[model samples]
Target chain A: MTIGSQVKQSLANMKAIHATLQQLALTSTNEEAQRAFHEAMLETEQMIAALKGRISTLEREEPQYKGM
Target chain B: MPAWLEVAIRSICILIGLFIITKLLGKKQLSKLSFFEYIVGITIGDIAGTMSMDLDIRLTEGVTSILIWALFPVAISHISLRSKKFRDFVEGNSTVFIKNGKILEDNLKKEKYTADELLEQLRKKDVFRVADVEFATLEANGDLSILLKRDKQPLTIGDIKPYVPEEKEPQTVIMDGKILDEPLATARLNRGWLKQQLDQMGVAIENVFLAQVDSYGQLTVDLYDDRIQLPEPQQKQLLLASMKKAEADFELFSLQTNDAEAKQMYEQQAKHMQQLIQKLQPFLM
Candidate 1:
């Protein structure tokens, strides 16, 4: 697959992980677990944002990859 | 020397010799002994027992026999380690009795194991149905190692992918009313912290029979007085519940709001909070 598609796939995986972490945080009864999950989710969100930015940059530089 | 005195001296000498020989033999003798080791152990024990009571056998001769018996096995084991063929000869090869859920009658006959005996062994392993067994082997030590079919296998933690926090062993800070300083240090806690915790609970350190600190730094104490019921720790649970309530409120705010920007912000916060809760589920739960 192209670099764009690979990056998109990674981005998708990160989002899924973030969603799972969020779900765990909501469902967890332990305070420590909830805190840990919330912290991890925030970190994952930052990574997702970073990936999104990279995708935008890639699309701008290579117009052919845009909307792929 | 009196005959009784001579007998006492001989028994003491034999006891020391037996202790030294057992020490040289290593811990394997204490655990599952191979067939060869079992026979060697029995022979040495019988010789020691005879040498202890019987005044006829000289101490020197008995000691020499025990030494040879003990050292020969040690030498054989060392040699077996270097040679696979020798190892197989000394520790007999394990026989496969069942393959692909079918018992091999020929192998069973070769091992002189009856169909009834195989079923009995299988039953001992909690495998009632022979058809459920995918692979079964009779170990050299007479242990039946059985592997169930894929469908019959129990589900493990690996089957479901979830974030599980690594837990450190609970440190026993107090045992029998005495504070263990080393364990407290290992748990990264000091006496002041422990004192404060005890004081908060209104439990005297002397009254506590056992106290353990878990990975979450929650101190659990058992008092000598069984009638006194200490409240269970619920701080973490309460905090998690409050966080969930906040997340719910955010969702409600997002739904009730008319302003597009305000609604979007509230929705984003709710989503973020939800993700945070999901991440903490394993540890908190």
Candidate 2:
């Protein structure tokens, strides 16, 4: 997959997870489940950061998107 | 008369101001007051006293004095939050006072407390006999914390002696005037079991306020209709904690005369009475 497309997919996944986390935080009465969701959100955030860095690198380099 | 009244008002206001400033300087949270806090408290008290009596001193002057006295501790607290070095220097670490009943004089000296004072504090903890102590610590806040020797301490269920449960009595089948189906189901006891227990006791579930299953599976129930047996410990402690309030009111009322002896006597007695309530705390719990 192209770097830009991959980044877009990651962002989309992070948003979905973030939304689910908010819902889980409210609905889950168990403290452990809520904490797990929060930790999941943090991990997704880190992944998004890493994916964005790669996309920026792709954009910076001239037309490297095409061949490899 | 208005001028005399204003003067009287200012005097009272000064006392309030001093109290506020000292309280705001924040000693209540900590068991020990630091040197800086102690100094700030004393200085504010002195300034409030002087400013109240001096007719020339304005309210603004008192405010500024209180504010100035207050700033040091606030600043110190802020720094202590961010700086570990400053925190350690301000409130020294806890020191071991006794290790297996061996008195550590050096720690006592560091705490600036005499041996007699340590013994007095221990006695207050009902550990008058030092040999009975296993570990004693001079906590950073100037409080003495003790770990007593094994035999001197109250034996818990896991001690040398063991008592086996005799029988499983009817578990708590109802609480707050409602039948507890879940607990009954979990305990494998049924409605018939509950009905029989209630029938034997000649009381209905609707009258119960609280119910619990003890370790031996016996149901302990408290009823709103029942004249509950509140054992002597609770009654005695409540009685003691409240007795001094009347004395406190008398002392507060006699503040009009401003007699130093009366004030000191009242304060001392109130403290003594409070300590008694504090000692009775375990029983209350």
Query: Which candidate leads the pack in DockQ?
Result: 1
- Candidate 2 docks at the CAPRI level of incorrect
Clashes of each: 20, 0
Model 2: lDDT equals 0.61
* Candidate 2 chain A weakest lDDT stretch, 10 residues: A24-33
Local accuracy of candidate 1 as per-residue lDDT tens digits, B7-31: 8988887888789889998998776
Write down the RMSD of all candidates, one decimal each: 12.3, 31.2
DockQ of 2: 0.01
**DockQ comparisons of all candidates to the true complex:** 0.06, 0.01
Error of 2 at B107 (Å): 3.1
**TM-score to native of every candidate shown:** 0.73, 0.41
lDDT of 2 at B200: 60
